[model samples]
Target: MPQLEPFYFVHLLVWGFINLLIIIYLNTKYILPRILYIYLSRILISKL
Candidate 1:
């Protein structure tokens, strides 16, 4: 059996933060623009 150590928790926390940042960056780079474009297009269509 393996014992849990403090460093394990620290590593997990660091990796979790890194993964979160990557997800946010990818979303902002790709998904966010498409979402904004769709939203703005809908608004423009409604106006016209």
Candidate 2:
């Protein structure tokens, strides 16, 4: 009943979307760079 209400549903969707964007941004900004750096270092070390 409450979940089916339009206002609540819209708010839930908006918050969920915002949270998703934040998570993606954090991963790309911080987590992905570190991972890529480590991966590339390993490859370069192997080549050398």
Candidate 2 worst ten-residue window by lDDT: 1-10
The predictions' CA RMSDs to the true structure, in order, are 2.2, 2.4
* CA deviation > 4 Å runs, candidate 1: 1-4
Candidate 1, residues 1-48: lDDT per residue as tens digits?
246687799899999999999999999999999999999999999999
Model 2 has an lDDT value of 0.97
lDDT of each residue in 1-48, candidate 2, tens digit only: 766699887999999999999999999999999999999999999999
Error of 1 at 11 (Å): 0.8
Candidate 2 vs. true structure, TM-score: 0.90
**What residue runs in model 2 are displaced by over 4 Å at the alpha carbon?**
1-4
Using lDDT, give the best candidate's number.
2
Model 2 clash pairs are: none
